[model samples]
Target: MNSIDSVTLEVADPTAAARFYSGAFGLDPSRVRVRSCEAPTTGFRGFTLSLVVSQPGNVDALFAAALDAGATVLKPASKSLWGYGGVVRAPDGTIWQIATSARKDTGPVTRDVDELVLLLGVEDVRASKQFYVEQGLTVGKSFGGKYVEFATAPGTVRLSLYKRRALAKVAGVPADGTGSHRLVLSGATDPFSDPDGFAWEPTAPLTVAN
Candidate 1:
């Protein structure tokens, strides 16, 4: 069956995009509806992201094919130094990423970056950082603390929030303004939304990982 694993848009008007998403994408009015008060709170204007995944399956290739067909790629696909590897977006504003089969159940010997951290898009760098700070985040000194170093626990993996532009600039890739993406809790996380309205919380704090 044809399926999408994840969806995130850096929209200006999330309230308006709520309708646009439901109609244009044919997302269910009921299922597509995500509120921060509920679960997945990761969007502009603070809306929880509703991610879709195929059941009993692994269909990364099919999803990749869909992007090749007509999806406007804002960013090209590439391996991420942060562990999880996937394109940030396609032009005309659509975000796509694969949820790799790197579950903890699979064991650290077979873990993928996908199982550790998740990326998110934000409007402002300092503002977004402040949001995470308000959530009681203790900033780490990575990229000069421009990228947040939060915890997933004490002994698990690490996730950091990076500005799209800076990351792309450093990587020598074009920065395709990606808006809102979800950092789904993989390990023990204390999830909370940053002040800028990005969904994140400390499931685990910063630590070393091999």
Candidate 2:
């Protein structure tokens, strides 16, 4: 099964960015790599990192923590058509969405955000979906040529694809621009970029005996 292992972000200050992510969202600092990058003069338009909590209270708490850690709130936490979620911009300019499903009694709030989902904004959702399937990922839930989600093994980050314009709206960013996505996904057997330019690199592929 196909699964996302890690995500790398390009930022001006790797130390500060890593600190904010680890402290605010309880993400492992080791999982987040910091790299030097030239200042991006354009607005972020392509992708978003998502945290999927099992409960609404966790979403609310995480949203608050993100703001406290110096992230700018793009959309306040509230119920939406998809579910309860809020959008925020990390200090390094990465967009994030914290969301939960519509379920009664979200349960106790935890300080740590455990699960993650990476949403890629692609120019062609169908094409991107087909690409991942060819790469050996099984399709989970998909919508009519607009959105598709891939099933991931336990403890791996889930991946999904959506139309670029639609995703930009969801991320509260403009739909037009060009630059590096400033992100990378590892754990695949080979390094590749999707139709939208999101890079996926091979980490440590499983080895089998001859």
Candidate 3:
């Protein structure tokens, strides 16, 4: 089965981005990587990285850390219909959402992230869903034409598609964006671009010795 191994963000200052990610989210390069790129991009970058935690306290912990690390608040952390979450924009122009489905604290607070999801804002959800399915990804969840999530291998980043306008609204940004997505997905499939121009590069399979 094809799965997204990691995500690479093209930023103007990779050093700063790496520092920010480490300080803000305690992320390592294993799942998220950064590289230097001055690609012209405006408005929303057409994607958002979601940090799914275990509970509301975890959400607040990550959210506060992001603020202290020089990220601007796009949406304040609070209870919502779905759960508790907040949106922030990194200094390098990437947006992140820290959230959890648990409304209250279930246990002691920790900075541990439960899952990392890469949500791509595509022009056509159905078309993009078909594209990923054809690339060997199995559908994990689907909500008609509004949203679709692909099942991924354990310990890999979750992949999902949402309408560009809806995704922008969720991230509290405008839907208009151009130039480059500046995002790359490392996966098991051959290098290719999705319908919305999101790049995917193949990762070498692990060799097991007998």
The number of the candidate with the highest TM-score is 3
User: Stretches of candidate 1 above 4 Å error?
Assistant: 1-70, 75-93, 97-113, 116-118, 121-131, 138-141, 153-159, 167-210
| Number of clashing residue pairs, candidate 2 | 0
In terms of lDDT, the poorest run of 10 residues in model 2 is 201-210
lDDT of 2 by residue, 84-197 (tens): 888999999889999888554456687656678888888888888989999889999999789999998878777899888899898887888767788877775688887777
Cα lDDT tens digits, model 1, 105-191, are: 222221112222334434465677666556445555445435655544442333456666655553334555333443333222354
List candidate 2 segments past 4 Å from native: 39-41, 103-106, 204-210
Best by lDDT: 3
What TM-score, computed on C-alpha atoms, does each candidate reach? Answer: 0.36, 0.89, 0.95
Write the candidate numbers in order of decreasing lDDT.
3, 2, 1
State the lDDT at 144 in candidate 2: 73
- lDDT for 202 (candidate 3): 79
Clashing pairs in 2: none
